[model samples]
Target: MSIKIQDLPNRAAFDVKSAQDLRTQFAKDPQQGLKAAAQQFETMFLQMVMKSMRDSVPQDGLLNSEQSRFYTGLLDQQMAQNLATSGKGVGFARLIEQQLGRTVTSPGELSAPAEAANTAGNALPLSTSDGRHLQYRTVLNNLPTSASYGAPAAAPAASNGDVPATSKDFVNRVWPHAVEASRSTGIPPQFLVAHSALESGWGKNELRRADGSSSHNLFGIKAGKNWSGQTVEATTTEYVDGKPQQVVERFRAYASYEEGFRDYANLLRGNSRYSDVIGSQDGTEFARRLQQAGYATDPMYADKLSRIINGPTLRQALIG
Candidate 1:
């Protein structure tokens, strides 16, 4: 039940080489349906593996301090540094924590600190007339010195995952791996945020089983019988031709949000159904491709998703 940071297995290395080769192979023919199918198969395989890991790990709902899951920094080092204590980056920490037997603590939390300063208008040279100590809010030190306060502290909107670190108060936490998923997998963070918001109602849905049990899913992704992962029964909406058709199905729950996000990225990146979506990191493009690739059955799914992302509420949460 206890896992030290050093003892946990490192699974961050994404084997994109085979994916690259598969992409090349898909390009050679471009005619065969093999490309799309290959992607889904690989994604399914990955999901199954994560499912296995989730099932194998036992949780008494106690996260040991010494038994922590260390997040490797493939992106930002400071985020990695912060994660060393809180245990995650913008996107990955959530995933890593889930694998280590924890669930996302919060969702839909972010803030903009600069506006307060802008509203203040050159106040006290932001404290200290020398202006020598003026630092960006993203890296504000928590020292007791007068320099740490009254000024808009570094309001990092998102550090890892789709969640930003701009907000000082830790109300909601993200998967942290969402950043890795967005940056490394090129899924675009906003899109991921939009999906998360829509899927689990910002982590306020039936993601859990009424008890504090692991649904193994943060996004409320439905489960197919063939899927080996544990399942949670929930009322879900199925998108059909851009319209949300109602469907109550058994959804696949991730042991952690990070795993869910990672699997979602792999599913898109590896599947040919999402080929129209590949290399297009734009949130809108990503949305369009999701519909085109048949990921969502809703007719207005893309529009709804893109609108939410472009809206002021989500945008405000994203930036500091």
Candidate 2:
């Protein structure tokens, strides 16, 4: 049965104990707890809406008695709760679930955090609950921990293909854009796709904001003087005298893959430094020229991209 207004506790009396109970339930079973919490939040929102609507109704001295007002407020509260409970509440719960819900991969196993998330975990200290960056940490930490008692889980089996299933999906999704880019830049679609995969770790890693949203910077293309857009500051590994060093850099963030690819294609086509890479059908030549043009600070950037372009994944992507 739905909770009634008469049964509701005083708003001020909704104390820490109630919230703690919710958090405890969340820790025990996140899916159900999140659903319940979302409904509660929705209920609170609806109550406010009801109060606003009630206040907007013009008051008549005859019907504006204190008893009428109190009873009417109670009725509105009940109606709000019922509306929220009907599975037609505003989509706030779904948005909350998409951001915080655990992705169950098996009976017990959870997918490892994305590379950007893992980097954030290692680089930033846990923030207070009220802090701006705490949401990501809280969401990630609420997942079943490594120490959580559960059945032994197996890793995902590879698909009936040469590449990882994730890679196949990535290639398939990005190939059409890549083909368009290739037609403009004289680069092969497979090479363009492979280069992006190499840059983004097969779409596992990309730059992220403090709020844990993707920058969608598939090419690791930094924002230079002539560019104007949102940017993210991230720690990148650079090679100096054959030694690796960590450096903080600002990178461009695009709204989507198409923008990122368009920018990447433009960078190669418009710059004289990358002239050696243009019109080069050979993946090795393209990779080497990009490295020579200071596309990245890593000494082995060419070799790494070459390896990716020559891998079975690229072959499969081309065939697909």
Candidate 3:
């Protein structure tokens, strides 16, 4: 019996068995199979866009309830699938099909496109509960390929001398300052260091002044009305409704790294909102409290910070 795209039932968003069946059909008949796979990808992409749009808008109307939201989500998913298969889709399916066709030459290359299709179908909508998965992927993607669970070689120091030559260098350079900040705040020094590393990308991505000097704002503490210090204007990423958007903002500039750490500690110590974060000994609790205290706008901030504190990258660097 010949397997036709129309013969297959419309698969659920995360149906692994259905994905496997699609790949099986692909092996038997590549042309129709490719079209089915592309449609599935387009459906998933459209659903994600719809979910993001829904999340951006407030849903606190009188008629809004969990039951209503659930049914609305179902409607969105069905609509996505229908639009994808209707031949008048957003053209994503056509684009994917065309690209895959051009790249896929041999039977061995089939698995690559098949996996791509399956990944799209298996994608989940962004939510607070799902932030850990996003955090893990972000950490993995950001990790240095040269060093996996080990100390990486030193990069050339920047001409400005603020950037560290390696992760080990970063730890050594900031350890004393972190310890000083830690003593005042009653937070662990490692936690402080990890937080700074997460903020600054281990000092390599520190904000710069107009003269290309380091802003020394490792904590990403923005300039507020009460602040009386040098400032730097730079574009920074802020997450709104779980989506990252870049905006230019003024940030506190420091004369030295130690001053930056000192100001960061003082900010937390002085602000009543950060009371829970001040004395946190556990890395996870510290990060969670910081996020709750409105330290950063990034939705995955806590998870990302906690991962850096507990992950092998920092540990390996510290030992090295």
- Best prediction by TM-score: 3
Instruction: Report how far off residue 198 is in candidate 2 (Å).
Output: 0.9
For 51-166, candidate 1 gives per-residue lDDT tens digits of 45644766445672212321111222222233332333244333332332211111221124423443443221122223322222211211110100112223433454443343
Off by over 4 Å in 3: 1-160
Q: Sorted on lDDT, highest at the top, how do the candidates line up? A: 3, 2, 1
TM-score order, best first, reads 3, 2, 1
Model 1 earns a TM-score of: 0.46
lDDT digits (tens) for residues 181-256 of candidate 2? 6657766566788888988887767677788777768889887787789899998988888899999988998887
TM per candidate: 0.46, 0.48, 0.51
Task: Name the best candidate (by lDDT).
Answer: 3
Q: Each candidate: what lDDT?
A: 0.43, 0.59, 0.66
* List of clashing residue pairs for candidate 2: none
Cα lDDT over the full model 1: 0.43
Ten-residue region with minimum lDDT total, candidate 1: 141-150
